[model samples]
Target: MHPRPPCRSTHTFTIAGSRVAYDRWSGPGRPVLLLHALLFDRTQWWPLAADLAASCTVVAPDLPGHGESPMWTGCTPEQVAGVLARLVESLGLRRAPVVVGHATSAPLATAFADHFAVHGVVTVDEPVDLAGSGPAAVVAASGVDRVPERFRSFAEPREDPGLVAAYRSWLDRPSTLRPVPHARHPADDLNPPRFTPLSDPESLASRIQYLL
Candidate 1:
């Protein structure tokens, strides 16, 4: 599914005092909200969004301080989730959105589902229990350099030291999530096919469609 980049419209909206910059690609199905991992910005979801955009209205937002968004003042996961919920509400999707969160955004995704209206949620390469383990652990868990040389170039600038340090308290904070009615797609299996969202977005997009 290496297709051309779909048309997108960049937007800025304020929710809970945090002004967020998001990219929206129109579609007619249920909307899909794409949340990138730590360090990376909304561009990380560009390809995946394009694939999903044929059937889903895809919305990718620069998390707080990343990309074009301003710094986020919220500290706790619940607070951030609340802001995200408000942001999604502003989209006025015809149906509830299916939120796809990658890596560190997992907790925030679940938190959003815990208290908001979501059709479903998908988490890619989620680093479960890696929070508060420090930087070396973060790198080891991320395996960012193992990707194709071409993608590595895109993955580099995202590893900013200042941005990483600024979000330290984010990983350490106690996650405030309540278990939702969740049923795993085969993609959630222990021995499923190996794929990074960037490396195999079409397959991931298939999994998202199956989940829906």
Candidate 2:
């Protein structure tokens, strides 16, 4: 069995007058930015983050108006994506992050990739609407997939107004993300091979590795 994955610690950064709070677990390589579903906080990703920490840095941000993060006067996918871009920029990345958005956040992931230099994008449980979001290069993680029974509630596509307002831009916009000429999942899989993330998290984690 593997040792326990690193625990998360909260930190905040100000971007354009808004305070963004995030949970971070230091590791190596490109940081993995974990965006939880609208109804849940960053802690929802704790189990998966721990498993991923050993492989690379894991960062989970509280969606604005949810968890420790306060609501932004204007919550748009581009706005939130900017905040996330700043967060990723703060990581001092050599390459772009593999943005993972869950449920409704999937569109937001595309928004991020649309505006930033992302290694790739991964939508968990939620299929990202690529029409208005993302790099053209898209592929299924051949071996990784799905949700855990308990996480079903969190995976539901439900969120409060603030989240809706923020995500609407992503849903409505036209595709701005540049098509990646080529993209695919990385060969590496989570170690220990037994402990899975939230919804068979290992499978999802393997997909995230595709970009890493």
Candidate 3:
């Protein structure tokens, strides 16, 4: 297991009656805000946070009801986006720092870019469409109460068992946010298609070289 990064000071701000918690890993460059998917807390970004913080100030926040943040009274995606917009404005991030989202957070990232000013946006394994026939279809087909189970059969054991194990552990945790009522099952919110293998380390290294 990787060592946990030292806990940073948390700042709380109110949005629509809910108090949101965020921590900053200060560095001498532009800011980058990291957002995690549903059912995950801010700590899920620890591995990437440390690496990114080496070059830039990194801010990771627990979205409305996730992590230690307060529960959100409203459940629509727009409402969630509003809270994020407020958080960004509160911090006075005027340079339009990069907003990165993972899993279900891809939509939120796009929403951020669409509704707010952001320099760049990155999404990892987020569904392209929330109401599409992808994950939601699987949920409807399986008739399962929880949606995450549908993807279980697709998870292959990688060389690094620890990483795979860690992901599995996260899947087992209960979500802090009030579940979206659109899907009957929890997993239904996830994109049914697996993340592309192009995101693997080897492929990513090659892509980075090309970008350079």
For this target, which candidate reaches the highest lDDT against the unseen true structure?
A: 1
Candidates 1 and 2 compared: the better one by lDDT is 1
Model 1 vs. true fold: TM? 0.82
Of the candidates numbered 1 and 3, which has the greater lDDT value? 1
Q: What are the per-residue Cα lDDT tens digits for candidate 2 across 1-212?
A: 12235355779989778888998888888888888765556766776777787778888998788788988887777788998898888877666777777644666777788788887776644433433332211112111124455554433332354454455554454433336422222332222111124546766777777668
Task: Provide the TM-score for each candidate, comma-separated.
Answer: 0.82, 0.71, 0.59
| Rank by TM-score (best first) | 1, 2, 3
Sequence-dependent TM-score of model 3:
0.59
Which model, 2 or 3, shows the larger TM-score? 2
lDDT of 1 by residue, 94-138 (tens): 578888877677777887787888888877666545655655555
| Off by more than 4 A, model 2 | 1-4, 127-178, 181-197
The C-alpha local distance difference test score for the whole of candidate 1 amounts to: 0.69
Query: Residue 140's C-alpha lDDT in candidate 3?
Result: 28
Candidate 3 local Cα displacement, residue 66, angstroms: 1.7
By TM-score, who's the top model here?
1
